[model samples]
Target: MSSIEGRHPDRNLINMPMKQNLVKEKHDASLHLISRDFETCIDVCQKALHVLSSTVDLQQASDHQEEMEEFIVIIVQAYAELDRWQEVLPCITQHYSGIENVSPNVLKVCLLLHAKVQEFSTCSALYNIWTSSREGREVNDSDLEMLLDIYVTQTLLQAGKSSQITEVVQSSQLSQDTKERLIATYSELVRETQLAEETASTTALPDLAHPQNIVDRVVAKGLRALRMMLMWIWSVRPRLSTRTLYSLGGLATLLIIATQGFDTSNRTLEILGNLMEHFIRSKR
Candidate 1:
């Protein structure tokens, strides 16, 4: 009896290490399967999907469903890296019914890629799935806030809808800290766009300014001056309130029109000069 009892404990101890080894092996295999080549990755993902859909075995179906979602993320990343957006879009659309099961990390990567490629239409579609998905519900509020910020910013920038951008940035749900960061990003983008427009206009103006053409020279010079003034306004506009900026802009427009007709009357010139002085002071 004593010998039998001693052997029983020894046997249990021996089996514990084997069980641990098997668990480790299973984990290693899953990782290996995920890291395999593209063809192999697709094969694995498809096999997982097949098992999930056809299997009547509850345990097997549940396990395979989890594995399939993980592998789908891997395959999607692979497609994105190759810039095979066409393939990625279809695959996402077809399997998107299961997106609630997809990991947030994978969702973030997909959203970012869509944003980068200027796929606003796709991004908008995916955002609906994302907002309604179980995984999206599982996301922390702070994370959701950040994701919304990124989406709105990219969408507005791509669409050139500055008004919408301002509306989104003003949301009370957005944290103050994030609001400040987004404001800075918006300001930077505005500056860059203004600079690009100025550069293009400058490059095109030289063709219109010729030595032998008096009319063309005058027109080009006037256009150049107008562009310079616009640049000045764009640079300073963000620093002031919208109301103040609009008032100043209107004043400048009226002065330009009044002076354009060669009105040298004392009252007209004095009014134009006073408006110009106000515009200059506002810049300071």
Candidate 2:
């Protein structure tokens, strides 16, 4: 009985100081966090963590595991507020042996952090666990699950891994509407990829018909008039009386002349006049 009492008191004495130190650390850390002093909060947490790590007693360490995890959570928030996301995973993995050992809420935090940094592989792994029936059972918060789904989906999309997203989209617990939207997004991405590939493979030739000078412009105008005339005739041919057909033919001829004669030279008109005179004299 004497030996038992002595061991218990000694153990209590050893744990008592550590508990006091942890309480002080938690208070200071909480103050720093409330004050928006993230750096200071992290420092306090680190100091406490050092002390926690120094405890060799297995029972004491197990007893203080919650405190250690709390410190890590504070550290995670501090790093996140600082925009030092790259350091978050290392900090988390340092305390927890692996992601499997992390609590669901903390694992969710890790997933978001990884997604934020666009770390696809790690984010994907966490996402799988987060949605798993056995290990990833988060509280039945529909909104939170949808939000996580959106984040993970966005990460996969940004990485151009839409094919890999199909499984996730189909298996997710999000509503049918959200799942449909994701599928639509995936289809759009695939279409865009195909279009891009087609565009790249085809050799684009320079357009040769674009008018460069007055002559080219006039020729282009004539070609457009010809096309218009053909279309008009095709549309009206079956509806025309003989008289109407003749009138339409004359109208079409005038239209063609107007388009082609605007830039005609005076020399060409003079030559036409000379030919008329020669024909009249020969007739006389």
* C-alpha lDDT of all candidate models, in order: 0.57, 0.63
Worst 10 residues of 2 by lDDT: 275-284
The list of candidate 2 runs beyond 4 A from truth reads 1-17, 53-63, 126-154, 157-166, 169-284
Give lDDT tens digits, candidate 2, residues 1-284.
34534566534323567688788888899889889999999889888877665555532434566777788788888898898888877766665655655655677667667777778787777667546633345445454455455554557766677676667777777667878887777778777876887887664533444333454455445545544664466466644444544454445445435644555445434433443343334334
lDDT of 2 at 195: 86
Q: Assess every candidate by TM-score.
A: 0.45, 0.44
